[model samples]
Target: MIVTADLAMSLDGYIAGTGVSPDNPGGDGAEPLFEWIHNLASWRERQGMTGGEENRDSELMREWFDATGAVVMGRMMFDTGEEFWGDNPPFRTPVFVLTHRPRPTLVKEGGTTYTFVTDGIHSALEQAKAVAGGRNVDIAGGASTVRQYLAAGLVDEMQLHVVPALLGDGLRLFDGPGLGPRRLEPVRVVDTPLAAHLTYRFAT
Candidate 1:
């Protein structure tokens, strides 16, 4: 399965701007820093569909949607707060959500469930792989979880959405005690209305 991490970044290399505190903000104040995503398309038609013309960087975006089968996300992602499709999210396959503590499996209408896995990203990856059915397993996350897979070299591809802004500091996309140099092998680059999409293959 494919392992990919998608994120919007500021020009100064900040993901959530300086105010996205994990404390009182719980990363709320930084919400306006950068945001994204779009509407659904008829899978049967095979006709490409995105939120708007903004995703002129359709090359990688389309590739992501087409390749993704199973999604392994971090805790923040399972909050069911990304209600793009109302009470139900669009992802139909099993989504393995990585968390530190246990939680109940939250099943939604569009076939996506918030299955919390307290075991770690690797365990989540294993579960995602099983249900992946030979398709790509996407690492949908909030930095730390992506870093977990990155440190282990579990992620195969990464699409960096570089937005034109600067927060100077905040949560870094990749950081920690054990992390070292993980070189990026550039695959392709394109422009989107809100940002520039850069595709890089991790050197394993």
Candidate 2:
């Protein structure tokens, strides 16, 4: 199974804006980054909402959701998104959360269960792969989590939904050290009015 990551990033490379907290999860000026999928039919269906545009974006969303059998994310992402996700999370498969603090397994509706992994990224990925049953393991991130995987060379592919807006200061997807200068082979590009869907595979 391949390990993949999907993120909606701003033109300036920020995945999230500044002043991010549980109260202000997406942070300031981050709305533009995800405005593309907000009204997609596939995205709305996963959130238990109804009536959204059926277009190329929606099709891509459906493809990703169907391909992902399990998910891995950081603790901060879990904490911030827990309240908003409610009982039935969008991930119908299992999810392993990377965190320092230990917590009991949290089972939510719609086949999503949060298994907290305190050990590290490797252990979390191992657990996720074990349950993935050959399907892809998606790195569902808040920037930091994706960075860790990329640094460790654990990610096989990455799909970036590049939005047009720019966040002057915030969490960047490729910030910090130890990420480059690695080569990325372009796999696909789907340009839309809201964002440009760019997919790449790590060059060996």
What TM-score would every model get versus the actual structure? 0.79, 0.98
Q: In model 1, what lDDT does residue 39 have?
A: 25
The C-alpha lDDT values of all candidates are: 0.68, 0.93
lDDT of 2 by residue, 98-192 (tens): 99899999999989999999999999999999999899999999788998999999999999999889789889888888887899999999998
| List of clashing residue pairs for candidate 2 | none
Clashes of each: 2, 0
RMSD of 2: 0.9
Between which residue pairs do clashes occur in model 1? 2-136, 2-137
Candidate number with greatest TM-score: 2
Question: For candidate 1, what is the TM-score?
Answer: 0.79
